[model samples]
Target: MKTNYQREITKHIETNQLSYLFIMILFIVGLIFGAMIVVSMHFTQKQDLLFYLNQYFSRIDQQEILNHFDLFKSALFSHLQYLIIFLLLGLSIIGLPIIWVTIFIKGTFIGFSVGFFVYQYGFSGLLFISAAILPQNLIVIPVYLFAATIAMIFSGQLLKKLSGRRFIRFTVEPVSQYLIVFVVLFGFCLLAALIEGYLIGYYLPLVRQLIN
Candidate 1:
């Protein structure tokens, strides 16, 4: 049986399903755009990227000792930085477009990375991506998308109030709810960081072999 809190949350989701769908489509479009850009890269550009990528992998190979703590810190800090930005963006009307851009850019970068990996190393690259990238992103991406969607909805509410929509009061209730949701999302970010920092090392040998 669902508690009242769960019921309310479900109702809210049902009400905002269209917004979620729209944001998801936007992210997917960005991903496709990124992959397409990879396809269109000039040979010289690809070579430059390949050179850097090989250098990076070589460094990692040489440094066989991985610092799990440092990786965790890096991943957690990165997630928190973006979450803070979304929090600020949700506070104002002009931030809606910026939030959209942030989400799109995130998707684009991920797509481009995956595309480049597969382009360069064939099946091995795909395996590396599945092992190293997907595990963390399986949690991270949804958390971010949820944050972006919530930010969008909050900003929309502010816009409504600004436009003299009397029924939609810009009250403490929404603000508190927004903060609470992000706080919960932050916990998920920590889980993602753990995966990125610790879980990926389990596949270290495979990743190194693929890169080389």
Candidate 2:
């Protein structure tokens, strides 16, 4: 016999699967929009980006000019901004549209980042993914997706509350559970931030060396 915990987990998964799918589809749309913008840009612009990339990498290797600490700070700040947006959307009652927008913006950012990298570096840009995006994003994207889905789910429940379909008793358990979920997801975001700060810098030099 399945325990109550097991059944609850299964039920949540089944219930949220469609919502997750809907969010992912929106992300895909955003990702495509981002890539399209890069694709349609002028060749001169692409060359400029290529030149800047080469110059930046040369500085990193020969001059040791890139401040890893500053890079980490920037990366962490960027990530925390993402985290805060999703967290707020997930916890708020009327945040579904914003959540979708966040998904699109995130997709656009990644699509542009990856697309521009490839456009500038050609085959070599693929190597940059190993160091730059692959590591942190591997953890971060899934967490964002989960957080978004949870936000949508919560928003739906809140709608039900408004309609007098459920939670009419004003119980503390549900609110406490929502807070606990946020705490756990925040901790996960911190973990991703640590990886961005410490590990990604180590990967960058190695990846650049291999690609060059």
Candidate 3:
């Protein structure tokens, strides 16, 4: 406990954790603000968001669980769309704004979806939300933030490199690290997809039954 090296390592780890937390908070503020924007829009704008939500939820409620592989493939396809965006965010320093924009979309969609479900179904919608959204987002949202944070760090490094600053490193190491994180994050996404495709199918009908 008294060793200087151990203390230094611990200190560095704690500092890094704090820095990540700060950045995550900033990202969350942006996300929540985006969500609030959807929630706060005037009647016409809300009508547009609501129009889509109506179609989406009606389709969701009417969906029949099909073949396992087909369902998994479908779920995987949806997750992959977001995965591709995160992959791009990690690869391109210029895509930080893209990440921010995607985060906004994510937040806005979740907010609008939740608001709509609650409005349409009242208390019963919470069960639908729990069944459909909670399981995957539990993993996916962290991965989103984690990927965003890594991209933010790399973007800063790229800026330093552009300015010809010394003691700054860019390129391969960061990219390799990003790829590693991407692989791990995608693995989690795969798990979420599996849960969404197969497991949730079983549970969602049961949830609807309880609602009835």
Candidate 4:
């Protein structure tokens, strides 16, 4: 059964290779654009951002105990909202462009975050991000990318059906399978939220010490 599932997944990717490539490239383009935005920021703008970051760090230091549960709830809620958008967009035939925009925006935020860290503290910035950001994003990034890709693919399928280009495989999998995939993806999002909430909170103090 596992073998059959793997084969089906492999076949699915093979069939949608072009869509995956296009989505991946779109995300990369967003990342580059985000980095460029960092480079182009005015000195004052950079300082303002840096000031805010410092204030955040100071709060973390001053607090005797962080509310990790609150962090988990916030992260999970954000992930849920993002996934809900993809789910709705996947159901709509006109959602293709919006799905692309969503992926790009996600990439842009990630790129901007890493760019800001590296720009501010050099190697220490890299260390801080690796500890603070990369842990959760290691799962979160792929989850978003896969969700976006599948959403686009499903949207495309809906378009084909509307255009009278129906295929047997479309009928075979149907909306149920598409929805199942999103549900499974959401489970991964849950794991990412845990990492974001608990693991990152644990790591931040260490990262703060290293950077300081």
lDDT of 3 by residue, 1-212 (tens): 46996896578557568546855666566656655665567878767866885665455567744355677788778777876776776566587677667765676567666665665566787777777778877887787777666666666556657778465654587678667777877788889878877887656656665344
lDDT of 1 by residue, 62-168 (tens): 76546778888999999999999999999989999999999999989998999999888889889888887999899999998999999999999888788884665
Global local distance difference test of model 2: 0.78
Q: For residues 1-212, what per-residue lDDT tens digits would candidate 2 score against the true structure?
A: 99998998799989789998998999888889988989899989878877888898887677475466776677767766876776677667789899888888999989888888776667788778766778778887887888888878887787778888455766788768766776777677777777776777666667787557
Which regions of candidate 3 fall more than 4 Å away from where they truly are? 1-19, 26-65, 165-171, 210-212
lDDT minimum window of 10 residues, candidate 2: 63-72
How far residue 89's Cα lies from its native spot in candidate 1, in Å, is 0.6
Using lDDT, rank the candidates from best to worst. 1, 4, 2, 3
Better of 3 and 4 by lDDT: 4
lDDT against the true structure, each candidate: 0.88, 0.78, 0.68, 0.87
Which is the leading candidate under lDDT?
1
Model 4 ranges with Cα > 4 A deviation? 165-173
How many Å off is the CA of 20 in candidate 3? 3.7
Candidate 4 accuracy as TM-score: 0.93
Q: How accurate is candidate 3 locally (lDDT)?
A: 0.68
CA RMSD (A), model 2: 2.7
